[model samples]
Target chain A: MSEERTEINSLGEFGLIELLTKNIEIQQASTILGVGDDAAVIDHFGRQTVISTDMLVEGIHFDLMYTPLKHLGYKSVVVNLSDIYAMNATPTQITMSIAFSNRFSVDALNEFYEGVYAACEKYGVDLIGGDTTSSQKGFVISVTAIGEVAPDKFVKRSTAEKGDLLCVSGDLGAAYLGLTLLEREKQIYLESPQLQPDLENQTYIIGRQLKPEARRDIIEFLQEQDIQPTAMMDVSDGLSSEILHICKQSNLGVVLYEEKIPIANETKEMALKFSLDPTAAALSGGEDYELLFTMKQADYDKIVLSEQISVIGYMTDISEGAHILTKGGNKFKLVAQGWNAFQQ
Target chain B: MSEERTEINSLGEFGLIELLTKNIEIQQASTILGVGDDAAVIDHFGRQTVISTDMLVEGIHFDLMYTPLKHLGYKSVVVNLSDIYAMNATPTQITMSIAFSNRFSVDALNEFYEGVYAACEKYGVDLIGGDTTSSQKGFVISVTAIGEVAPDKFVKRSTAEKGDLLCVSGDLGAAYLGLTLLEREKQIYLESPQLQPDLENQTYIIGRQLKPEARRDIIEFLQEQDIQPTAMMDVSDGLSSEILHICKQSNLGVVLYEEKIPIANETKEMALKFSLDPTAAALSGGEDYELLFTMKQADYDKIVLSEQISVIGYMTDISEGAHILTKGGNKFKLVAQGWNAFQQ
Candidate 1:
């Protein structure tokens, strides 16, 4: 490095990626798109190839004190699958690379792979290749998932039209509440070694947080419904943040209904128990791993209202603000305050 | 995760990977091969696709005390590229991800990517996609490289025959000696904070360790020579270890002569300085990133007398012990004591 030093926070994660990669130009004819999108696309044989990656860091992403290695492994695969799902494609293969501190016993790693295997089995995705290395500190996982879809069916976040219905897969905020419960129990156990976690009533919330499933089923459901989403992305960073991404990319605004936002009863109770607003958790709390997509209103009724998919809002002209209408009919502008690991 | 506790050491790295993934069955028809080769192959459209991954962790892989961030980033990508080269494929795309502790400044990461960008430019590879996450420990890099080769051109480690010539790319042991010099200087600096390293004379060796290059050039040169290697692997884990992999897989043996082994002059001098056997370092040193391959004897005249490729030995039937003809004219069984991060 030069004698001059600059803090990482001076240029946030996205800013750093842009600065470092500004000179990068795609050289391969196979690389149809690079560096920007829900995933990279390589034109293969005849169909389009989709590739996406995600990395999970210990301590920053999870507290292994309460997070099981199996769930961590499973979640690592699911998060990448979620990115593939965001592109409206089914993941066929994934490569996982793990960096582990020796503090973790070999058995711990076995258990971790056991969970990865389980997710692979459930999703019908192949565990193709990976690297195993030793970290100087906590655990780290990076997975690159590859999938294929017809070039026409692939959804990009830059194509939402005005008046398109903003649909979401399943409920949100449950995972965030689950994490809060786990953290609380971890602290309680830390203070009193013999204290057992009273997690009897929070199974749904805790399960959502620990072993959240990717919305692969939604992809199949959309296929059956014959509705191609105009714009789509995974709700890993809360609905508000994802909505802003779609709006910013597609150059549109949205109007969301607070009453229409999906939140399970279990999540609401957990939020109340923690003395937190359920809506706030659903809006800004992340890691839901649900599909947030937009489709033309003409196809709304075609998507049979099931427990899994819900219509929460609709896209609007750019002049209209991206706002949330409360149950009391008051509108508030939406702004993103989602997780930013580089902020500190 | 059950009440049972098992040791991962009992399984070893490969064994652990096998046991954990034994139950995973590929369900996607596009996935042609998985988990058993240097890279995974997926049938896309009409073309066969290849993907490989590798991860590097600080302390276990490199000591940042003497290593520069730029070189670390470059080596991380080079290491992954070696896997592609091992398969006799040319890498065209890469996804680079990093997890770093707050100790790393934005400028430091920029320098790191500067190295990565340099390698990409040198190799004609594209940076397609990646993830950025926060690590609570030292820096970690995980790279996934995708490449394409005519299905028939790809080589495996299990294809060498009895009469094939064993060829290695460039020289060996230089990287191993380079690491020794860097470690010695690091200890000196630790003892006396103001001590500047006497690094002028050790640049070649130290540079090999700090900024090793993958022999992608050899792949291109071999193609030009019209000599396809029967079996090949990158010498990341020492010549003895890699040769053993081919022997165990192809059921063959090899006879190597110490006098014929290539060692750089600087490396030999550094070995004597450290009171280490230069030949021993050449035999077992890891991270040289040289290609160890076997070719048909008919192609001997084409590869020999070339400055870039060296004919080191020849393959034999399995009954013949894999032996090394020492400078003293005594044949000794080759020992495999390759680098092991866990044991470190």
Candidate 2:
């Protein structure tokens, strides 16, 4: 990246906004107006809109010491899009609001927006209107994603019934292991400024952490297969915690099989190298951005045709409780050991 | 007000979110789902949706020393709704995402939510979804307001004709004067802790500053009167700057009458007490949250029936330039002195 620094102060707030949003290309026919107005108008044309928001703060969410601005920007958007996909909706538009201190330059912001636009284009979502201002402290990002779905077609977390097959898309626990590796490298670099960090042969894990993509393909594939999920949510706060949410909200119980949990080869290798259990990481780790859903037993034959998905468990009655059977046939109650950001 | 503090950590992120949102009552018929889902679903029933977002950072956009959490929360929602209303639409839902450091208590956040729900009820909008997390520093707020309008009924800022009549709702600069007075009091309070600052008979201006209301009534009245604005926007950045935006975006100029600029009596007196120009304050001060709009000149007679609105100017061809004619017959160029949050 060029070290060409352009002071944000040189351009006023409006000027900076103009500079950033000048290249916005509207891809959605629903987008009647994009930026430059008080608001953006979208006509979904009878499709119900799905909306979700997320806020990412500096230090709390990401450490700039190891995170690139572009990747952070990309991850920021991908996280919100994941929520829309979790609802089984096709994301069509997004609004990105950001606040930064003087610590960031216009070029840095441009880099961030470049990644934002890249993700927007890939997801086929139009970047609509948003607010940009200066923060007195850390960089802050808030994104609101808008997706469209047919009326009564959206999925929820409380719709699963008894005997539904629990499924998740792709592999998990990679992003958490990736974060651990990056933090380790950052500590080494901090202790010895002259030493170059070792991060070879970990591109998949690092990419999972830095530029995690939302499971748009999973959503599309499920729709194309005519498999409507009884309950669905993204694996953002780990598989165990998310399954617990499904059971709790739907007033049902789940019997998860430990052996069936999907863990990538890279994730398992890294977890073991770090003296951690790969199964524990897969069940408790977060930020995988994979799709976790439950479907009727009738879709079993059709689901097996897709290699990208795994049937990890089945929903049981409330009396059975939410539990996971280990490889030794020992059942343990599933607890939400998910990341509690407020925890000390 | 209660000192029985509850640490946000005691209840984890999910717990706190449940506690905060457990009482949300869905009010919109278009809303298919509210909180607790991966994403909120809303069916506009064929109405176009207008969406706008705004991010407010602590110490830059607001000072918490004198800002009550409730008013801050109320103001946050109102400010975003003002934008939706600016589009000639009826606000239906909002998503609020807030991040705060350990400095904030659960009680404080509850106070803020109290104001948020109050504003939601008053505006007949639903709090459909939001994100809350612990920040590493001061509180950060981002709100996305969503509204519904009939097909092709939403107004824009660039559609005003050359001879459109310019109008604004309510008085201006009171909020600016109120901010000036409070800031002065804050300074005095810091310098002399024993002396209680004098703020008697300034409730109007103070309320305008601390708890500004969106011009919902103005939008309703315009709709009831069957008046469609050619162009409209909320005066968030000051009268002069907003008119300049209208002229620039519409590819037209404007002639604003200084004498017609509506500054309240209390605001004028307060400006005089501070040795400031009332007109200048009205022209440059921001956060008024009033509607500045342009309509067909033929609706002048009908618009005058409403005492809340004042016709201040008329649009002109680009050759005429944007200027304000003073009471003394001198014309001056209208420049943007709007609050640039990035300035040192």
Candidate 3:
């Protein structure tokens, strides 16, 4: 963002696309072709390809009032990459398409692509083919991540067997609480433009929301340790919602121990400040981008090798039903309180 | 066309996705997993995978007043498939993500998916994965089509040699004329609500704009004839612009004959009604979704087997420059009047 603004129409569609993609450095050997083609070509060398897609709309998904363009770009790619990692696949390439209103400028998109390239560089994925178009209103982004996995090795939610140790990588609920804080700060700023946003130096929680990373380390560690989860999924939805999906899809019940759920100190502190239950946030707050998985009990010793991993519960027979044993010694039926964007 | 309407929020995001995707019967042998997972899986069976993406925004790329939801759905998929086919590949799967405001009902989405499935059935591509979310404004669709090509057989736009025969498949400019007609009708309807719309029975042009098909037949025909194109791309941004791209990318020049550019009889009639030159319309009016390619002169004999293809030009040395020999025997330097959505 500079004082001088160059209109998008000045460069036209082809010129703008060339400007945006000109700096892309392809990193994947699987990416036989990257950008500047009708379609990108990939040769996975006999590996099964895994693909996932995600769409984000401004105002509905993010308020640009506080979100930086670069972080927005990074998070967009990271979210789709999380889905690929959840499938136990190595992301190799991505196609990103964006539609923006006249409000966006070339410089604005340049800053955004700076973040996109940063993520691509860090994650070692190639920026492949995409579409650039104009929108009638706010900015919209759609990203598709492509990955590869060894044949028959890709994890699925429907394969968690009974007695498997339910686990998760990294902390949960920070991103949701971070969003709550940002929204509050946004409201305050709208009412008092002169006043500065009091983020309370909650950098950890805020960073979780603005620049969350896909749990690539967990996947890599698993690969290094030869510990394959029977079932796994990324927690874009809340942990409770994701747990319900594994249970429903696998036709197995699960007993989640609320006491064992991992929450960072900052997340817990922020929850208490907001008068929200930390456990509740951990269960129902979404967009953590952490990996939730179930592994065989025999691998428990190996799983503990990573200090980031937490054993949350165990899968049970379907007859037992999905439930959560609360820290207060109360057993409650688990329900999917996943954040629904369509909620009225 | 249901008497009862179900609100999208009533079903929630997951429920809506389930309803839309529940009927998908996988049609591709490469699609190992479709929907109901974090990501979809595909195995290209040693063939190189081709991927392309497109995003269409309502009011920007399409007008809902004249475009049926079903046709919009079908066109969205077809446009992406066209990119894949441009690479000389057989499309196998697609991921469709859409964001729509609450102004739409669940039944409306059902109709859109109806057309999506129709295209999938016709193209024999599996609908694998997608993201459905709420938009703050109009409908936005993002589709990524995946295809497979025989190893080292996928085509590129930068491989045309001098003296290669430049060709195009199917007719062009009809879609642009059709859009012009629709816009005028919309303007009339907007200005006078009492007036009944008169389409003038321009079915062919209208259909080209509303539900254009990808040139899958041309690709199939080429494969059957073993006629590999030297340079190739889909005619998306008008013939003049596409030809310029071919020349610039291939580092060669082209001499196009305006008389050889195929314009359907209906297209010519519509252009005349609009008081526009038919050849100019064929050169500058886009959204044809037709194949534009350069083939070896040796393959020229096999190319005529399909009545759909027409030899429009020949590749030339760079020193010859890119020009069009007009019907009146005037040679003009080719300029791209490609449709620019970002135009002020």
Winning model by DockQ: 1
RMSD of each: 3.4, 13.0, 13.0
Top candidate on lDDT is 1
**Candidate 2 residue-wise lDDT, B154-265, digit = tens:** 7778789999999999999999999999999899999998998788779999999999999989988998888999999898888988898789879999999989989999
TM-score for the A chain of candidate 3: 0.85
Instruction: Assess candidate 1 and give its lDDT.
Output: 0.85
Say which prediction, candidate 1 or candidate 3, comes out ahead on lDDT: 1
| Tens-digit lDDT track of model 3 for B1-344 | 64554544455333544553444444335544344321233446656677888899998889999999999989999998898899888787777888888777655766787788778778877666677777989999999988777776878887899999999999999999999999999999999989998889999999999999999999999998989999888998789988887898799998998889999999999999998877777788889999999999999889776789999999999999988887778777887862221121
The alpha-carbon deviation from the true structure for residue A149 of candidate 2, after best TM-score superposition, in angstroms, is 0.8
Tens-place lDDT digits, model 3, residues A1-344? 54544444455433544543444344334444343321233446666777888899999888899999999999999998898898888887787888887676555766677788778778877666566677889999999988877866778888899999999999999998999999999999899999999999999999999999999999999998899999998887789988988998799999888889999999999999998887778888899999999999999999786789999999999999988887778788887762221121
Q: Work out the TM-score per prediction.
A: 0.94, 0.86, 0.86
Cα error of candidate 1 at position A199, Å? 1.0
Question: Which runs in model 1 stand beyond 4 Å of their true positions?
Answer: A1-5, A338-344, B1-12, B22-24, B338-344
Better of 1 and 2 by DockQ: 1
Docking class of 1: medium
- Scoring only the A-chain of each prediction against the true A-chain gives TM-scores of 0.94, 0.85, 0.85
